[model samples]
Target: MTQAASSAADRRALLRLARQRLRARVRRPNAGDAITLALPAVLVAGALWSGSAASVPELATRGDAAALGMLLAAAVAFLSYGMLFRAADDPFLRRLGVESRAVYAERAARLLAAGLALVVVLAAYAARAGRIPDQLLPIALVAVLTAWGSGAAATTLAGRAMVTRSPGSGWGCLTVGMWDREVAAAAPLVYAPLIPLLSGGAAGAAAFGTGWPGVGVSLAVALVLARLGARWWEAAIPRFGPQLLEMAFAPPPPAGVGELSVGRGLARLLPRAAAAVWARDGVVTARRFAWATRIVWPVAIVTLALLARRGTDPGTRGWVALAALSVWMLQMVALVGLGRYERGGRRWLDRSLGITPLQRVLGRWAFGWGASLWLGVPLALAWGWWTDAGPGWPWVFVGAGTAAVGAIASVTAAGWR
Candidate 1:
């Protein structure tokens, strides 16, 4: 075979292998798991859709369409970045004599396919609504392409950052230490369009224009970024491939001083049995990078609230604050299962330790509530204060209520397990 043909075959083979691995990992969901996961997601999506439908008339304008497109792009980019890192098997592929470029190509193809599927779904929805302008359709398509390319490049850079021990400062160091280098690297990409969308100026309008010229420029930029990402992947693989593999397979490190201190503080605040469970859950969550990264959802909600205050009404701003707190609560509740179910032999070990079902349930609930309160209070207050709302005292009560709901829901779900 010619070199080009040989390369094509390699990519095809990699794609097939990736699909097989995905299928192998994804077990058929039980009814309880289906309801637990699907119900909340469906409700949230329905609420968001209703709100969006109410504003469909406003989407006729170029600025509104641009803003919406940017927001969609940001969402796709962030999800793609997270998914890439979470499921990366680059080192393993490298060991199989598959080139890094091939791996990157396969991943990029999958991301683009997913982004295009989203575009199709949104396009169909907009068509049914009959409010979206014809000109904005291309803009939406370009936005997805841009997002996919940006996400791929960001993920590559983030992977590179993870294996590097270079000293960093500020939030970069802090987030990287938490195994959130993907978030740190992708933050700028995620926020670039958001800033303009929130600020709503002439420049912002021009940058996110829904014209064909803008779409063409965006497509070109996306292609360039994808090219750069491929080059970066090829370069980094030779240098950092082994380190990435090692990090992927390495055992979780022991809990740090911060975790221990948090546990000690919770111990003093709670009953002995519950505190032990709370402390154990905290440590377990901290040690698992994937679980730790779920904190991003709440943080993203808060960030949206902060940005949304510029043109939003007081009532809307209040709701945004409430949503931020509520999401934090829900995020914690979702994590309860991750702590108990993901690790092998964990349930057996818990039973061996003489931890009763009641204690386990109470501890999980307390941990979820406490963690929600710890993160949500400050975020809600900040959102309220920044939005010129009162000290956000009302949101604290709202958060507490939601946290209780989440805690109860978590315990009930655990019971089903």
Candidate 2:
């Protein structure tokens, strides 16, 4: 084949591969996953509708902001949830009829396509609602493109970092570590939704217009980074072998001792009896980098609340609902990680120490609730100060506290099982 023909053939092959993979994914989704994926859209729509008390321009602005948030959340979910690749499939595909590079190419292409789709969906939604002014349309497209490209690049790097630094552990331990990294990386992207605030307002379209060159530069840099990541993976796979690949994608086993650790700290900060547990939890959290997520999660919620305040009319019930939901989601993540640590790493020690089940449960609650309040109390106070709901900030904090307790109660109860 001529060089041009060969390149054309390769393009065709990659497109074919990507299509087949996408079709396979479509077939695999059942009701549960489908419903879960749709939840964000529903929540966004509901929030927008509830805030209809605002003026048309205000509603439009809020809708646009929410759309931006939804896109960021989707990107974060893509990066953090699972193994970066089906690395195990390389040998099988090679034996059958595929090069490993093609796999990476297909994955990258799919990710890029998803980013483009986000742009299209947001544009269509805005156009349909007529919320975004015509003059701002081009700027909106540029902004979304910039965010998507930069986000994709960040995710690729994060995945590469995790895989490169991944230690040799059993399937279960490795999987847990991967999960931890996902949560940590995703916590930062929470701020991405607030990128729109930088534009200021409809009047600020000129601001974004001036930044167009920067956006283009970011997109180019992202493409280069993504390519580098794929190249790195393509080179790494051959040495990994089928066994290691299998272990990488394998279902995680029950959580265990590897999930917990004791770092340098006071095991005597609390009651003499519970000091060890408290110290271990504190040290493990501080040293392991997991504590960062606790801070990030709350910060993200507060950012969202502030954004809502800007987008919606004061005293809108939707704003409160949105804040409450953010807290619930943050607490859910904390509970899951904390629960796993307790069950896998600390349970045996607790039993031996004659730590009553109540004490154990309370300890876990204390750990999670404190983490929640670190950001939650200030978030509640801010929501009150910013929104028409200021007078009811007391009630808002009460509700926030209640939700935190509920999350802990649920997680602790699950540990009881």
Where in model 1 is the C-alpha error above 4 Å? Answer: 1-6, 18-27, 30-52, 60-62, 127-130, 157-217, 245-256, 259-272, 287-337, 354-361, 378-417
Q: How accurate is candidate 1 locally (lDDT)?
A: 0.59
Off by over 4 Å in 2: 1-31, 44-98, 148-229, 236-293, 296-327, 333-417
Using Cα atoms with residue i matched to residue i, what is each candidate's TM-score against the true structure? 0.68, 0.47
* Model 2 residue pairs with clashes: 267-275
Compose the digit string of candidate 2's lDDT tens values, residues 262-364.
3224333445444445445444544443443444554556555664557246444565456555654655554545555465546566677787656554554
Question: Following a full C-alpha superposition, what root-mean-square deviation does model 2 have from the true structure?
Answer: 10.8
lDDT of 1 by residue, 24-78 (tens): 5446544334445566567646644654444443555657655766665755665
Assess candidate 2 and give its lDDT: 0.48
Error of 1 at 395 (Å): 3.5
User: Each candidate: how many clashes?
Assistant: 0, 1
